[model samples]
Target: MTLHVHSMLIDGNEVAASDGAVVEVDDPSTGQVIATTPRATPADLERALAASARGWETWRETTAWERSAVLRRAAVLLDERTEEIAVVLTREQGKPLAEARAELQSTVEQLDWFADEARRVYGRTVASRHPDQRMQVLRQPIGPVAAFTPWNFPVLLASRKVAPALAAGCSVILKPAEEAPGAALAMATALTEAGLPPGVLNVVTGDPAQISERLIASPVIRKVSLTGSVPVGKHVLQLAAQGVKNVSMELGGHAPVLVFGDADPELAGRMCAAGKFRNAGQVCIAATRFYVQEAIEEAFVASFTAATRALSVGSGLVDGTDVGPLASSRGLARTVELVEDAVTQGATVQTGGHRLDDGPGYFYAPTVLSGVPETATIMQTEPFGPLAPIATFSTFEDALRRANGTPYGLAGYVFSEDLTTATRAAEQLEVGIVGVNSVAVSGAQVPFGGIKESGIGAENGTEGLDAYLYSKSVVTGLRRLR
Candidate 1:
């Protein structure tokens, strides 16, 4: 397996791993080592910190228009080479080519949005109580940042962190997930081609614990942002605490969908099926649990199972593949574990209860389980794969209660014909973002985040840019003497 994009981009140049160590990237669809990324050493991180310190000095001084132009150019370059980058993305991370292209398209749109938003980081003058006093509140860049990104949606998630950081005049060192690192390095390339100066953005893929520790402890790094699992988010929180740093976290989710009796069960079922199985159900905000009104539970389950079964599963590059393999063997095993536990506990397997051994990759059937006992392991933990477990509810309160029972509160879905029921459900779902009649909830113009233990902070929209900036209030005494 060979790599299309070379790795280890530090300061503007592409380099090889120190000590000749490399980590192989496997295509999850085939379970074969597709490419090896150069591993970053602690020494390399030292250089990155030094480079970032230098970058911040110049980057923070640039006019807003200068930064905005670079980002807009990046978006244009990405659009020009959509198929090329999307091919690399699909090969590195097992999402269908079409989905990979869609992710890239979304990332480009986010860049455009944030580019225009760069000029909108406005300051305000406040009234002073004293006649001789003046006060002004301003926003400034948080300084050099260390960003950690996940393998799932590597390019898009990394862009979510990097674009806003740059838009706010913060220099960033991106440590993309090792499993799928090519697309991130490709981003570095795009930014470079778009006229960004050296060291404004850097890419490092290596040992997570080592890389995170060195970057977090560095005095020059003022902010840390991550899009990963909850445990990793907690670990990042602990490390950033030592530095007392500015941080952003977009963590794991076990999203639940509430299907009401008044809604069209068939439509809800179809939408839930698409939501659950996209990216082979590797999405952090993908709907994992379904609570349907008892009157429509059977009908929803029947329709949902049919949609799940209709999906074509295979290598993502294939022409008509609807869902690809799990990103790893660990994810593959987790899906099996959750489904088996539910089945053994007497949950009925409505469809797809086993791995497709008929292939040469890490493929698991998109599974649907009904009558899942609350005691089942899948009910408590996030499967993070193409497994949907549903239960029945008698009332609105009952359905909402079950939906809010999870420790993860990233996103929630509600399908109700009554506007009051939808609004009430949206108000009480205990999530950062709620969709009254939709399951798809992410876009460049909207804020995306979670609540409770799901993680802190938000991304996209105006708030996303604010995360990389800090507010400063300055007051001075003004005097006019005769």
Candidate 2:
């Protein structure tokens, strides 16, 4: 299929880079260049920042009802164009068509949720100690925001930042991953068509380093939000610190799944396998380390390996393909390296261990490793791929200790029939979000983020809206006994 070149969305207009340079986007499913997007130059970034400043002025003054109306309309437009954008997402990010569509649907839901949230950003009238004093607290937009999103779940991640910022009346300049620029552009188009004023939302793609440094350094950007690797998040945080700008980050995760003996091993194995290999296991919250209770470890490993082997790995566009290729060659190499490292450190590959050489794409078979030692590299590192490593723990304390050993505190999961066991695991797991007998921990209504090295602050729910807002306290002297 022929794909069209995408242009950068700046100041409500689709334009090429000032230097006319472009970056080619590769289809990970086929290892082919499917399309190109304009590479944003330094000058283009300036334009976006200037436009954002102007947009912020107008947007912040807009009534909450008006902002809500625009977001609701944008959500409708996004819903209408779901299939078209989902195809683009599948092509660029190499996820199954169904998963791509689901991501877009989530994006639509986020917009809808934020639309209603816009009107609900309530302030409070404070009780005053003196009869003559009147006090109130108000929340105001924190000016323009600089948002950076990763290629995996590009559209959904972008919306997670943009929707909340917009709902809070903050202008946004979104720097979407160049690997999947079309989805963000499509979102920008929908918002613009839904009457978002020029400059309120801008989409730029190109050199990530250049764009981030310039945007974060600029005076126009009041907040910075990012969904990326830990290293990248740290870099962005450092840059934001120079200006003391408000920042939020959702970084990498090495989530652990604790399967207690009381739980149904077969059910837990099947569910964890499905969660582990979704999007070829590119998920930040993908279940990586499995600490199954010693009594059920053998059964869990057997079931998990069977489920992992059953996944159909192929091009995302093909029918019945459950797992797609890694998003890029680098991702494939990293996955390979992690597997090799684990094997060298005394892990046994129970199912898959090598790349799928059937085609030219960056594909790897869904792998399950048994007897993975804590000393193995995979135990400490976040293997953001379709690889599951299982180990056994004799006691609940041992499970908790091993699970909490990683520097990452993004997410953790537990499967136990006993409420006491599940609740204890939930309370003890050193992560921001915990899932009991399930891996579904993210949604528009909940706060999604991590602790420790995973990230700072939160996304979604009312907390997400608060990220883009600043509070102001007002006090007035009232006439006594008037």
Candidate 3:
């Protein structure tokens, strides 16, 4: 099913920009202009915010069960069209079809999880010191929210924030990435078909900086959420600070994977390869850095090199392709520069580093390099592509220090059979999330966020719902004063 790209969803209507400007959206797999979305202006922003603000009153009064029902129906619709949505995602985002399908499934699960949690949102009651004098704490919706989503994992990331906010009785104005607007439009269409109240969940698509800043600065939006780079997150934070608005950010990551001497060499190699190549390494939590114990460094490198070399790079539309193109021309150029600079800095190329010249897509080979020094630019920056840089460490402390050296503290992984060593490493790693003997560890029931420069706030499980809500204290007094 071909879906028309929508530019705006204001007052429960799918409408185009009044100015009629458009943005070209290409399929990264083939570099074909697949669609165009309305490029909204400040006027469209105002219409959405006003609509959502007015809708908040009714949405906040709506029953949690009603909201859950809408979400549940939306989930069903997503499942029914999973393949259609996944194709659009793979074509636009350059993720392998299998991974795209998995993301679609995950998005469905998130909607269901948040839908259930919406009903379970309960307040607390406090006992009073005197008879007839009681204290109570209640959770209330924060009003209209401005949600900004990134191009990577477009559907899943947006669902992560939008689903929870709507579930918690809040009206949302979504500004999805212009590169992949189909998935968001599909989601909005589902929500509308599921009988969601008009204006409760309006969507607006356009340039992020121009649209997000204006929305954040407006008093009509009481909260803001984003999933993007550290620099963008900070900018959004600064803008949100003007209103002291609540914000949840899931930003950049330079995730490290430590392979200790005790780790099973084959398992470590396989897991690392899978994590690094997933989404062609566009994932925020992809295992980009590998710090192996000196004794087992050769063995780990050999296995990892073989695994990465065996990957099949091609268009995501094809079956059996392990890796796909970068999301756009800019992503391909950035990855090329990082690899070229790293090699110039004396890093040894292990297996793959060349762009695939066979196709129109912006494809790059899964790359593995060794002997990358601490000062290499790629060492600190997230390649966000199919490049894995490996380094050796003589001691556990050295590996820990190097892993924690970056400003990002999002996610880390350690492969060790020794429980004591794993525990120590997990404790010392400053990241908010750590993977022991594994590479992938994100779920709907866990609080997911980063520390330090990674960004602020958390999402998922109970905390995600709490992010879109506020707490109020109530006190009761007797006829006589205390």
- Judging by lDDT against the true structure, name the best candidate: 2
For each of the candidates, give the backbone clash count.
0, 0, 0
Across residues 1-482, which tens digit of lDDT does each residue of candidate 1 receive?
A: 34543568778788776676888888898878878887888888887888888888889999999999999999999888899989888988999999999999998998899999888999999999888989999999999999999998999999999999999999999999899988878877888899888888988888999999999999999999999899999999999999899889999998888999999999999989988899999999999888888999888998999999999999899999999999998988888888888999999999899999966588999999999987898888778999999988898888878888878899999999999999999999999988778877899989999998888889999999999999999999977777
Question: What tens-digit string does per-residue lDDT give for candidate 2 at 215-281?
Answer: 9999999999999999999999999999999899999999999999999999999999889999999
Off by over 4 Å in 1: 1-5
- Each candidate's lDDT (Cα)? 0.89, 0.94, 0.89
Query: Distance (Å) between predicted and true CA of 186, model 1?
Result: 0.9
Error of 1 at 146 (Å): 0.7
What TM-score should be assigned to candidate 2?
Answer: 0.99
Rank by lDDT (best first) = 2, 1, 3
For candidate 3, write residues 413-441 as lDDT tens digits: 99999999999999999898999988878
